[model samples]
Target: MSIIVQNISKSYNKAKAVEAITFEVKEGELFGLIGPDGAGKTTIFRILTTLLLANEGSAIVAGFDVIKDYKAIRDSVGYMPGKFSLYQDLSVEENLTFFATIFGTTIEENYDLIKDIYIQIEPFKTRRAGVLSGGMKQKLALCCALIHKPKVLFLDEPTTGVDPVSRKEFWEMLKRLQQKGITILVSTPYMDEAALCDRIALLQKGSILKIDSPENIIKNYDKVIYDVRTQNMHQLILDLKNYPSQYSVYAFGEYIHYIDKSAGFNPKDLAAYLEKNKHSEIEINISRPTIEDVFMDL
Candidate 1:
């Protein structure tokens, strides 16, 4: 295992931040911690990177104990915090050099590791990091984290505020990095991005709901799903919740995805019933389960 977290737990002033979380990341795997804000993804990343010690259990990264080999772990792991933390006043190249120097290395020494990513923003090397655009800042932060050529990279919501194109570009860069034998552990709240990972852990309220590859996770969905679209979407949602024979219902994009309590429930009958209730332009269709749907079901 490139990363192993065994029953790790962390608390703050008697409140549990992470409760006995356990997961493993294989070498060269792009593992994702998928969850919404305040789901303890940051806490787990901190503990794994040795920034904070766990109150219970243990964690090992790249064969080094997080606590006992704190320095070693620090040297072997590259961490990009959720917030951009590079020096604002420093130029792009200056910030990269500073981080390299702190790690007892030089930008030239490990230039190849981040060369591809850095070159994209090289024209802006002289620009102050503070004045750079959000996408540029994100790339600079990633390049700095990778300057030392760490074995494992922990990216905490690296695409949070980036543009969609930049987000897609970033994932492509990560795919190339993984090809070079770097284990990547990334966390994001975006369900769409979850499908890009080799495996994902769905977290909610500081607890893991499920862990598996995206395909397997969706394939394992045991409920029948239906997409119901009507002219009165808002009112349709309200009506569906109160409708008989509903297992669960929630608004999904332009349609409301619902699950019936029993397999025998007839879709036509349900539509007819809604039409009788004065619902117009009602269209209902069965759809494949998505990661978002699975999250809701969980």
Candidate 2:
């Protein structure tokens, strides 16, 4: 494994941030920590990258212990923090050069590693990092991180605040990097992006709800979810939640995704109930389970 975390725990003051958290990432694999904001994803990344000490637990990254070999781990992994942290006053080329020089390398040494991503922003290489657009800054940050060609890469919410097109492009770049044998551990709040990972660990409230290939996690979900909508969505949700047999009720895109506690759940029964409640244009249909649905259920 390229990364191994066992029973890791951390806290701020007396409040627990993460408790007994554990997971691993294989060499040359693209692994993801999928969760929403405040789910402790950043804390885990900090621990593995040796930036923060865990209150309890052990972690090894790139064949070195996080504590005893902190320096080694720092050199062996490339980390792009959740927030942009590159030298803002410096031009793009300057930022990249600074990172490479600090790592005892140069752009020419690892041009091939970051060529795909760098070229997109090479046209803006003369612009100051602080003035670049969000997507451009993202590309610049990634280029700086890869300038040293580290064996492992850690990206924390790399796509957050990025445009849809740029987000898609970024993931494509990651897929290419994984093909080059770079183990990547990325965290994201977007459930749609989680499907792009080779494997994902679904996390919530500082605990892992499930860990597996995205397909397997969805395939093994035992509940049947229904996509339901009515003319009055707000009232429909309240009514559904109050229903005795309802297991879960939450908004999902154009409809409310509802699951029942009983196996004998019938959509007709629900429609009838809604009709009696004065709801019009009721629509309820069996919906395919998605990563988001599974996360919400867990």
Candidate 3:
């Protein structure tokens, strides 16, 4: 395993950030910690990267213990924090060089590692890091993280504020890096992005709900969801929640995803009930389960 976290727990002033959290990442695999904000993803990242100690449990990163071998782990892994932390006063080239220098290496030594990503920003190499656009800054941050060619890379919500095109490009770059045997552990709130990873851990609150390939996660979900919508979206949700057979009810995009608790439930009965309630243009159809659906169910 490239990363191993066993029963890790952390808290601040008696409030638990994560409790008994556990997972592993295979070498050369692209793994994701999939969840929304405040799901303890960042706390796990900080623990695994040795920035903060867990209140309980152990973790290993890149073949070294996170605590006893903190220095080695720091050297062996590249960390790109959720917030941009690069020197804003430095130009793009300067930032890359500075990171490379800190790692006791040079740009020429690892040019091949960052060539693809760096090329996108090389034309603006003279611009200060603070003034670059979000997408450009993202690429530069990634290049800086990879300048050392570490065995493992930790990206915490790397695409949170990025545009759709840049987010797509960033994931593609990660796929290329994984091909070179760099283990990647990334966290993201965007459920759609979970499908891109080789495997993902679904986290909520401070616990892991499920961990498997995106296909398996969806395939194993034992729920038949229905997409229900009407003229009034808010009222539609309230009505569905009040339905006696409702197992779960929540808004999904333009529709309300509803799961029935009754064994012999029928959509016709639901439509009849809605019609009686004065709802018009009722549309209810069997919908495919997705990562978000599974998370919401959990």
Candidate 4:
């Protein structure tokens, strides 16, 4: 394993941020920590990267203990924090040079590793970091993180606020980096991006709800799901939640996804109930499970 975490836990002022979480990343694998804000993903990443000490358990990166061999672990890992923390006053090239210097290396020495990504933003090398666009800033951050040729790259919500096109481009860059045998551990709230990972751990409230490949997770969803749409969306959600025979009901995009409490509940019966309640233009259809559905189920 390039990255191994065993029963790691962390807390803040009596509030548990990470609750004995455990997982591993194989060599060259693009493993993802998928969850929403406050799901403990960032805390776990910090523990593994040696930025913060775990209140309990152990984490190893590149065969170095995160606590005992903090320096070695730090030397081997590249961490891009959730927030953009690069020196805003420095130029793109200067930022890269600064990180390289910290790692006792030069940009020219590791240029080959980040050349593909760096070239995209190379024209703006002289531009101040704070003046760059969100997407460009992301690229420059990535380039600095890679300049030292670290064995593992830890990206915390690397695509949070970028444009959709830039987000797509970033993931493409990740794929290319993975091809070069760099193990990537990234966290993101986007369920769609979960499918892009080799394997994902779905987290919620400082606990992991599920861990598996996206295909397997979807395949294992045993609930009967229905996508319901009606003109009265707000009322429909409330009504569905209050419906005696409903097991689970929540809004998903343009529809309210729901599951029945019993196997024999019929869709026509639901429509009839809605009609009697004066809900017009109701449409409910059986639908396939998505990552968001799995999260909602948890």
The candidate 4 region of ten consecutive residues with least summed lDDT is 45-54
- Among residues 3 or more apart in sequence or in different chains, the pairs in candidate 3 whose N, CA or C atoms overlap within 3 Å are none
**What are the per-residue Cα lDDT tens digits for candidate 3 across 1-298?**
9999999999998888898998999999999999888999999999999999999999999999999999999899999999999999999999999999999999999999999999999999999999999999999999999999999999999999999999999999999999999999999999999999999999988899899999999999988999999998899888898899899999899889999999899999999999999899999999999999999988
- Tens-digit lDDT string for candidate 1 (4-68): 99999899998899998999999999999999998999999999998898899999999999989
Error of 3 at 200 (Å): 1.0
What TM-score do all the candidates reach, one by one?
Answer: 0.98, 0.99, 0.98, 0.98
From the highest lDDT down, the ranking of the candidates is 2, 3, 1, 4
Model 1 residue 219 CA deviation (Å) reads 0.8
Q: Over the stretch 59-142, how does candidate 2's per-residue lDDT look in tens digits?
A: 999999999999999899999999999999999999999999999999999999999999899999999999999999999999
Q: All models: lDDT?
A: 0.94, 0.95, 0.95, 0.93
Clashing pairs in 1: none
Clashes of each: 0, 0, 0, 0
Q: In model 1, which runs have C-alpha deviations exceeding 4 angstroms?
A: none
Worst 10-residue lDDT window for candidate 1 reads 235-244
Better of 2 and 4 by lDDT: 2
Q: What is the lDDT of residue 132 in candidate 4?
A: 98
The reply for model 4, stretches above 4 Å from the true place, is none
TM-score of 3: 0.98
User: What is the per-residue lDDT of model 4 for residues 1-298, given as tens digits with 9 covering 90 to 100?
Assistant: 9988899989998999999898989999999999999999999988888889989999889999999999998888899998999999999999999999998999999888888889999999999999999999999999988988989999999999999999999999999999999999999999999999999999999999999999999999999999998889999998999888999998888999999988799999999999988899989899999988998888
User: How does residue 275 of candidate 3 score in lDDT?
Assistant: 92
